[model samples]
Target chain A: MMFFEGSEKKVEAVLKPGQASLRQLGRPFWAKMVAQANAEILSSIHNDDCDAYLLSESSLFVWDDRFLMLTCGTTTLVHAVTEFLQHVSQDALAMLTYQRKNEYQAQLQKSSFADDLASLAPHLSGNAWRLGHLDGHHNYIFHLDRPYCPEPNDATGELLMYHIKGEDADYLRSEGQNIEQIRQMMAWQQLLPQFQFDDFLFQPFGYSMNGICGDRYVTMHITPQEDSSYVSFESNLPSEQLTPVLNHLLKVLQPQSYDLISFNMACALSHATGVQAIDHAEQALPIGYQMAFQHFLLPSSQVRSADPL
Target chain B: MMFFEGSEKKVEAVLKPGQASLRQLGRPFWAKMVAQANAEILSSIHNDDCDAYLLSESSLFVWDDRFLMLTCGTTTLVHAVTEFLQHVSQDALAMLTYQRKNEYQAQLQKSSFADDLASLAPHLSGNAWRLGHLDGHHNYIFHLDRPYCPEPNDATGELLMYHIKGEDADYLRSEGQNIEQIRQMMAWQQLLPQFQFDDFLFQPFGYSMNGICGDRYVTMHITPQEDSSYVSFESNLPSEQLTPVLNHLLKVLQPQSYDLISFNMACALSHATGVQAIDHAEQALPIGYQMAFQHFLLPSSQVRSADPL
Candidate 1:
């Protein structure tokens, strides 16, 4: 739920009672209204104008401009949307958006997880177009079927992303920067590291050469996954070789080697635990890199700026 | 903060220990390590593999890596950005976002707020663009001077919002039906009643369109402000007033209203809130000759039905 108070202090004061607690039978009906004498003065919504930079997929619904989350399960679209509006008002920040897989028009033709168990097979060799739903609300939604993705996890598969809002997208369309300018300034090549997961094994997979929708924005286009054994390999990696390579890399790369913050965590997490530290951090830091340049193996005795190099 | 523990749960369980303030910080050496670790984590230096979506302003710094936020006396660009990231990450949603902003190259250009005010003699608007440097994490920031559009609080004299993120933004862009489709479907020539604030002296004078940004998603553009009056005059109505009129209409016309769960809330917030709820609702929704049917309103309430009229 997103609650838009003017200042941080006002936000804190107004959202003092704000929380997401699971209720008994129905949805979590956390109390939204917190009226107190000392409630921080906020910009009045009345007569105040709000302008939103929206793409085409954007639609605004009115439901008393409230911020609550109990509206997630409205069977009827109207009730559901009204409920979402209320939730949006409360905390647009932490909303766990959900929709029935079969309910969406786009998903109508798609087979169910059970019905398409054979279809749920992972891609082995080549690539596959991954059609994961627009991940979800700013909340914790759990337990979706394989139809969502061949992956095992729930709600946490955003390895590839696109730009949908802001000047970056607008500039890409309006200003029309040349390919050289794009390549040099933005370093578009380095943005996303190329890795072959079970979903896509194809090399040099370009994500939206042109903007995805009428030059409005960009998109991540992965090679399609045909019949394959994602299970044979651990997670997306082929367990036969990757496990050892990853383990070897972990053994060498140390934290505290760099002044840069994330690198320090890498060293710290590794030092704090062991090889497991690198594995543990994958959830928070999903992208990994080469141990030589991306990371350094610095033992404490000889741990210096030049030591890793 | 929103730790999405997928396969890396075991790793997360271990790395989570370092966050314990008391145990780690009790000793200076460990504290330094912890502080360093904290900084490292913030910097995003580790090129670990996970599905992370990041948004950036400047390509100079591939924040796919991380950086630090250190104050340089005055409120510089660096300070603003650090504060912005810190604010967004306060919630797990923002931290777990597939989207992020990058302005690592948006160097720390410090300008005193007092200095900005003291130069009021010239009343310069040329430097309005400089205000963009104030906040680093703002994905699509548009800063303006005060007094031009007042009453919405003058604290920062700026309005910044991050609208799209996660899959919501992706769907907004990648989908076939663009913004125009939704707009045409929703905004079916909504003719709204004359809107007012209190009496004839004060009323809404114009309609404004604002594009609010999230991560990759764009919400429909709509923002209408009420224009107040000090002197009496015989003024004609505004063609610009159409924005709000259409906004109120588009919201009330959503397909969710017809659904089983939403009819009530749909009927509630759909009616504009004013003194005497019953009278206002009555005027908005007539019994037999309902304004919904007689005037500018969508024919069908079902989003799937697609313009029944």
Candidate 2:
């Protein structure tokens, strides 16, 4: 089914429900939405009726009346916008953020993130994608409400993606990499000790798991098919928790290459400093593995780095 | 439309028309077939009703009663199998070859290559795909007739694909690569002095050109989008002609990483010898660039290489 054909998208939506939890209402609602969005339903419950949804392309988490859905491939996600409206009252639609990699031209064209934002918040002051290649890396940021508009000197929570290639890709796709075994070991290890999670191993191939830590969530999808094997990790954790969490995931996955998207929310780190921190955190990478690309996206008033953008 | 979204497919069919050319009959027939296949047309004529057919996803060439259609994305190409039957008398069909990379599970599942071949020639004995990752290099070859059964002793044409990443990917996607300009210069430079060709620079991005030298042909497609810039080259030329031809194109394209598919057909080159030839041919690559991978598809009778597969 090409679980990794297109870009994996992550959407975060805040809610205004009077109740503290929407656990009971979230599962069936998402299954219907996935069917409507033309995605295959693999699972909708992780723990005994816990509200976690896993589709072939991506996953979704619902908590504290807030919701987050992440998926990939040529899914008709725009339809989910209207469906989201049906689930939440107008007042409960507090905020929304949609982000995707800048690949897949037709899929991107099919999206209406800007129009959807305008309809949801008519007077919004910030809307637009930060799209372009900076240095040797590509950055794509789509925002609604509080746009990805950190102050020039502010170093916000960073978001990053890494693409594993070469020997790393070989190891992960090989049986010796023992991904299925790793998944079992991880379940016991509980990388995030505080979170309750759900996992699924696709018949004969692929692996995915979703974890919930209070209001925040983290998910991973491993496409272990021969030619296009890939693995992705995403979370909405605080900046302080980024390195340790990333390190733990890296240890398990051992991806050959990874594309890191650091959405620096409101921090004060400089470009060089940020890269150095990432390099140190990922120093577990084996020898001959090179940091072949690096990029930085700064606010308009920030002093630009001398490197080519 | 993401012309490069899925794997690009190439289908070569030979016919036994009485006339030397199919020029008068080819265009309208393909236009009808494309309409039936539900594809949008971009151009079918190169210069004043020329015989080339270019669709949003693929291109077609008709000459000497032979046809080659190359298309990418999700086009229902299997339908063309029946369409070919209608176009020719029972005895007029000569040979057919269909090629696609081992990506796109949905599309690959949709293909009826093996089924069609079985119906066409039930007694055919050879069939198998060259599928595996050897020494960090992935290779996939499925055949209709001879099969990619290169004996360890037989030096069949070798197929190789290299992925350029990081800084190299950055440089190739930039306008500074001057590929379109190189195409113009090459038209006059006559790098392959024996061929005549037509070229098109996609509006604001990408470049594609088709060249014919007798029954042999060469084609190139470069997608320069920032996030997924890629270049592909394919030909039916002999092994003796490959090195010089590849060197010229590499010099002009300067792709950071290239995937070369050398289909070793009925040759006697040993595995190590073939890799040595490729390494020597690519010596023009700048310093610090490395040959990070090597793989081979040896026949069952031949001993496999010591490298991990």
Candidate 3:
């Protein structure tokens, strides 16, 4: 199978009080914007507080005054954000944050984070930071330089797992796997019973899902190739709910290593068993958010031994 | 500066007896083949046993019976090897080996190792093996399936250093650096006084050198960017000479990690100070070569701490 880049480029933006409701921009407009990134909107679901899109590459979410867009593969996501900025003036934005997980095949990407920063410079000013080693798993963040207050409930947690193992992982890689079986494998019902879910199983392989519960949401994207398996789980739920959700996914996927990221929230996976934190860093973003990142790996004793020559 | 892929694609082939000596093929023929890979022949050096050409990307060594070619960047090296194979019948090759180091930017390349293997399959039957994890530093090898015997002294050692540090590395990256300064910095005069050296210092930054002493040869390539610094030292010298050379380079480069690769020779870096082997693998190739690979990294305490976020 050809390699597919599963890591995502993500953007989170909050509109000013007097701005037009983002939901009112309509799906067609958002579809055009997504197309600018070389991705398509497969389908979308809506709740009273949000609109969650299931994209051909990843997912996008829209609320009255804020939205989040994430796309994977070789999508030029910066172009999509720039297109959106052309429609909405910078004065209409209260806060903006863009993030990119270091890619498995970064050279395939149409633009680097630095390139994206240059493209976005015309519309808004921002500060960027790289959070980990360039030789290993890392992340890049670009946020508007403006400062502001955050809602007590404004929090996000993301868990990115790599080199997954076990029968479940094999099943995901196997042919004839379906969405219902994957949902059952993930056990989202037990993990987030309050949310309503929508998911898609791609031809041959891959999976994506979006769940919405009033204002809070959880989304997942899975690429299960044996050579470079990866699964990412993200949620806006409080830490108590998010931590268990992350731990549950880790138990089922059983990755060799994983990274936990929290925005305006505390990371609590230090108590997880079997894995040790290999790297950790935290930053108080200028845009009124506390960002913490921690990478965990199975201890050498627990990790699979190297194959004998 | 834009990121350049520092990893190399390498090819080694042994021609049949009574065939024209590879050196007799002349610089023009080899230049055409190198041009097929989009690299230019800068200059060349010769000794009794080999003809070494310094290419814009890396190096090439041609002997009467065999030739070794290496090139980095986004060059389509498989094309060059394929071009050479077109002129030399498969029956004119007793043995052949193709190798590729895991690239820092794989997707930028014109073809993956698998693609190269497919292209080569038409020219010769071969067995391919991966020597390490796909998610980290690894190598891919494709060797013709044929019984062979090695010369008593048929040995090679290669040292690949990553994330180099110290004032020497900074000097290599800085503007206005010259070939003489680099030669002194690398200390080849002390390290291999017998060998005659020809080196190049790339504009902006980078270095490549080829040294020849009778039949044995040593070559070096340096990509000294701060974010993704790398230096590689390779030689066909015996283990005793090769081991000390590697240790001296390690001491001068002060890299965070490095890989020692030995062919028909034992790897002897287990006692290197400050670093420990994180991965090791070995294999007996069908073509009468024993290959061993070891990856070493500084202990956590010695590696520079993470940047404060």
Candidate 4:
């Protein structure tokens, strides 16, 4: 259970460039907090003004005015939550979406704030849903509305999240064995040529890369360990490129089996938009993978309506 | 690509329960056709009113009033297409969904009707979408609306499909080296307690079972080969219990890598309904899978609308 423990904590914070330069303060600031979270620092890549730190178990990205972090394994990400609040105290926290799975075993209990959901519920102002399984791996999600520090009417932007986790920890690492080959393939594909890329290879276990495309960025992380191998791809660009990006990512990682989850801030009434994204990958994926599971996260208070004609 | 040549031809025909019983006209009818398609028949199992057949490449399921057949490999299902039209002429064909993937190779050209799409396109009425990759494996879907022969609207029910192929199929056969053990596990699970189960074991390569659960039926096929090993689980039951059914099926087949496709005639506007079905199996699936891809087929002309809060 200790080895099986993993979490993906993504915090979206608002920062202003003039106050604290991302290039000058971002990398060092996050590196210290990663250590504070009890996560081993493997490598950190800086591009434009954003710093992407690859931890032993997860990843973190710091931009000029925004912060996004995810950590897994026994890393006490909860401990760093207070630190993040302190560091970005001046900058507003726009949104916070924390997700965790594989939370069934006892050893992972303390590391997972999900274990204390009842207590944590009061502080977080957002919607939460559990896949509802006590004996097996389960998915838990918590989302906070825009303007983390509440304001009358602040609609910064809609944050969309898409994730796919390979079914087995060991299988994930094995799929990432050909990281160099994948990079070469991506280069051949000429994905996002406009961006300046900063890439890093972890000494023994993993690799990571972050591309800065103007103000937007796309980052990828792979932690190829036997006990807990994981790879994550994230971007804040328009949805137009989502299909190709995901297709290339799947080709590079090639997980044997995986589960897909999407949190769409924009409207996608009947999985219509999400389904299109998956369809694009189907053409590129090698035969033999089943999209065994998929989910579109929505607020519990929301009601379903018929698709538009 | 040569080894990747695969096709799943699923034909659905309407037969009346009182006439042309599957048990009476099924086995011999399909056995002869399997030979006609240039595929060898491994074995067949009949239970209650449904018949399940295992072939060198894919599978077949026949019910009292419906027939579902899928064939892969160099089976030349296109040749059998004429034969199927002939046999089901009396029963009347309800619907047909023929899907082919990895069909770019020259060797499979003659066996694939896809090669004659120019000529075939005019005959089929449904919309078609080709993943459109000529050099690599791609998904191509062809669907025809019900009443294969003009008849009144007949809503049989929603059909769900889930399948997985072993990564090193040869390895799966080696693991499945224990045939008797699999049978014992099935027995312990009581997968279909009320129905009489007739199981079949192929000479040296595969295994299949069909359970006739009253009016509903479940069938499974496994061809654990190195180059083209595959296992499929399909059922025509209510969605309420679909999750548990799939869990047990996955456990019995224990496929390392799998693909799932669901053709739901019923409503599942939000992936919310679909996610619930998959969440049921999450607790049971072993590690090492990435749910790599998924697509929800929609009415070709339908448009999207925002959700009602």
- DockQ for every model comes to 0.01, 0.03, 0.20, 0.01
Q: What is the TM-score of chain A in candidate 3?
A: 0.95
Summed over model 3, clashes come to 0
Give the per-residue lDDT digits (tens) of candidate 4, residues A1-309.
113333455554555335565446645667777777787566766656667666665667776666666665466665566566565553354456555543312233344444434434545555544431211123455555433342322211111222223433344344334556546745623878777666665554455666665656676666555334445566665555545566655545443223343333122222322232221101100111111113222111222111110
Off by over 4 Å in 4: A1-7, A15-26, A101-110, A116-126, A130-139, A145-179, A186-189, A202-204, A223-230, A251-256, A263-309, B1-309
RMSD of each: 32.5, 13.1, 4.0, 20.5
The order by descending lDDT is 3, 2, 4, 1
Candidate 2 structure lDDT: 0.47
Writing each residue's lDDT as its tens digit, candidate 2 over A127-153 gives 334332211223333344432222232
Determine which window of 10 residues in candidate 3 chain A has minimal summed lDDT: A300-309
Better of 1 and 3 by lDDT: 3
Task: List model 1 lDDT by residue over B1-309, tens digit each.
Answer: 111100000000011112222222223332232232122111111122111111111111112212212111112232223333342332211111011111211112122222322332232221111111111111111121222221211111011111122232233334243444433433423332221111111011211111111111111211111011000001111223323433343243321111100001112223222211100111111111111100011121111100000
What is the C-alpha local distance difference test score of each model?
A: 0.19, 0.47, 0.82, 0.46
Better of 2 and 3 by lDDT: 3
* Per-residue lDDT over B245-284 for candidate 4, one digit per residue giving the tens place of the 0 to 100 score: 5665444544332334433323232231123221101110
Model 2 lDDT per residue over B1-309, tens place: 122433555665555547445466756677776664455456644433235665654667776666677665566554664565576653554445555443322222334334434544533223333222211222222233431222232221223223334444455455545665546533424557776676666655666666666656666665656434555665666656645566655444443333344433322332321122111111111111111112221111221111100
Q: By summed lDDT, which 10 consecutive residues of candidate 4 chain B come out lowest?
A: B279-288
